[model samples]
Target: MHKKETNLSHSKLANNMMNYINKNIDTDINIDAIAVEYGLSKFHFHRIFKEQIGKNIYETIKSIRLQKASNLLITNKYSTITEIASMCGYSSQTSFIRAFKNRFEQTPTLWRNGGYKEYSNNILHNSISSDVSHTSFSHLEAKIIKTKRKKLYYIRHQGYNKELSKVWQKMMAWVYTNNIENYEQIAIYHDNPIITLQEDCHYIACVKVDDKTKLTNTNLPYFEIEEHLCAAFEVEGIYGDILKFIQWVYHYWLPSSGFETTTFPSFSVFEKNHFLNDDGIFKVIYYVPVRYV
Candidate 1:
């Protein structure tokens, strides 16, 4: 197998492990069980997971649990912190508060009452939730739009914050080799990075092709981004700012938008905005699947 093929194979296993963990977050997440399920020795599985995703399994699971706890806190739907902690996999409320305070510099109650926003005005500075911020997307006009299905050839990645630049570089090489460097670029996030550990989130970077384009004789897989009625919000900024923008959209925008979501997950549609001083900024349109209430 070629180098890319090897990466793809490892990527798939890492993704599977994440999927399983997500499905069972409320339970004891056993790495040994994951190793046996994958038919790899525990040692080998641990090493491969770190190599492929750049984070240890324990760290990934902890991150996922913390993110869930924080999101629940922000939603304030749970009646008490104790219940929230248990649902997030902490057996003891005291232990959960200790862990939460250690990570966020605030207790669960404080985070629920907007202390998190004050401390993490900049989302990047926070350690508690992968998806957190007080950043405003008020500048955004997120509204419903219907889109036609798109055909694309894409590459999938699973890992803690997989380097976007590396993804673009390698994808560009493939596109350029195929003589389609000028094609439109798009990305799909199957899991929200804010809610999901960066190492565990799944994403696909795609090169757009017309319906008539043939995928034969190439190993790159092709699929359609299903058409849907969506609430779309576009933001222009550096990468970190883009993440904060997303957090704002989900944390503030969605719950009060008087709309319900559909089956498809939200995704970021990408386009280059400006390139100057060896720096490239981007314009990304984040779309959430929605239906009118």
Candidate 2:
């Protein structure tokens, strides 16, 4: 194979491994099983995954499990703290709570009760705007179309403190396994309007579900999309890097584009077949609600 083809094959392998790990969060997954799934030797898989994803495979599993447990706690009215802890692979309730608190800066109960606050005070949160010199707007073409309302299975992520990688893995895994795979557009909607330029900005990881009525069967949280006017911007390469594009839109695009920003929290849209774009290159479609002032 040519060098580029070899590179693509490796990328595909890495993505497949990620998806497999996500799908089996509830199962007894170890390094050997995961490495073998991708046809890579254990040592090589460990090294490659770490270099590519910036985390070892074991760390990825643990992080994802914790995130799923946290989601189950806040969104499910029927779930108790103990049950949530056990489901996420934690052996003891105290250990679960400690890990949860360390990640979210609030207890599970506080998060469930809505005691956690979204990141506010933009200037305070982002003090280094002067350091970034890329104020020149990327002349992105805008296309407007009315989309039908979508039923979403969503869990509110409370507190601006936890890593969302695990939460994302679990949510996507559930969606992929369930019959709701048809509704493939995934989104993370934040209740907090302010973008603090961090991964922990309080938000909801959501997938369009069959109906809000079936949300109970999946053991996941749920919400429905309300119709609204949205301004969309597509950013290529690593959705985690959306803060910079958001900064550009809020500070530069909105003002010059003759569009007024809404107070509502914007959402990031993940389209199906996005992996096919530029050969599994990551991208994010940021949806900012807009209106004429």
Candidate 3:
């Protein structure tokens, strides 16, 4: 096959992987099976997935699980935190609390009571039991473009499952103990290049800290998302499957979009309530660099 054909083939396979993730969002989805189904070894799939989506299988799963848990926290009339956590594949309440706080900056109790003001009411009220097995996303397109720069404060983190919790705990504890600032208006920026760049990505979760706040090593490496041309695309369905969709965009969409690549690494912008549902209709504006075509 020609180069273009080969790229297209991979895009199709990646799309299949996304569909499978959404279909099995509520169940114990297996990445190994997906690897096998695509005639790829686990390692190969991991590499390809990261190269395409900027994240790996583990991150994808966590994103899906958290979104489902969020949906349940607001929508399910009778679900408890324990039930929600267990159903979402968390091993314990402590674990669930840690993950929940990491993603949303609030405990399950607070989130439940607050009712999520940033997301749509539909997102908070959406059904959680629908199966994604029959769903389709074969008509999506990826486009490249230029965008303005975005300034953000970032915190770097590294570890295994829910390990970022420790970092967050330390950060928040420090914030409170020292009277640093409020986390309510801040969005944690995940800046770790590994997590931001490839499979097994780490969190550089950051909140917009006050400018006058004193800093330590735990507080920085804060930077800006530079202004440049970007390649933007949408990844449908569960966020866990986001990597493969990203792979489709980078490996296939860019080449076909008639856009020359630039140096800046891509980043995703989350819109309102974008992370609140399992099979949610979220639009992630991925920014990639573009040069003259």
- Candidate 2, residue 48: how far the Cα is off, in Å: 43
> How many residue pairs collide in each prediction?
4, 1, 15
- Look at candidate 3 and tell me the lDDT of residue 225: 47
TM-score of each: 0.63, 0.47, 0.39
1-293 per-residue lDDT for model 1 (tens digits): 99888877777677567656665677777789768988899998988788877888998778767776776665434247887677678889998999898888888888878775665455444433333434456877886899778776777676425265677677777776666534677777655555444556666677786556544335565666668998888777654565566667657776567765432556767767222113656787878776675
Note the Cα lDDT for every prediction shown.
Answer: 0.67, 0.57, 0.52
lDDT of 2 by residue, 70-91 (tens): 4444344455788767666677
How do these models rank on lDDT, best leading?
A: 1, 2, 3
- How far in Å is the alpha carbon of 257 misplaced in model 2? 1.4
Error of 1 at 279 (Å): 8.3
Give the range of the ten consecutive residues with the poorest summed lDDT in model 2. 191-200
Ranking by TM-score, best first? 1, 2, 3
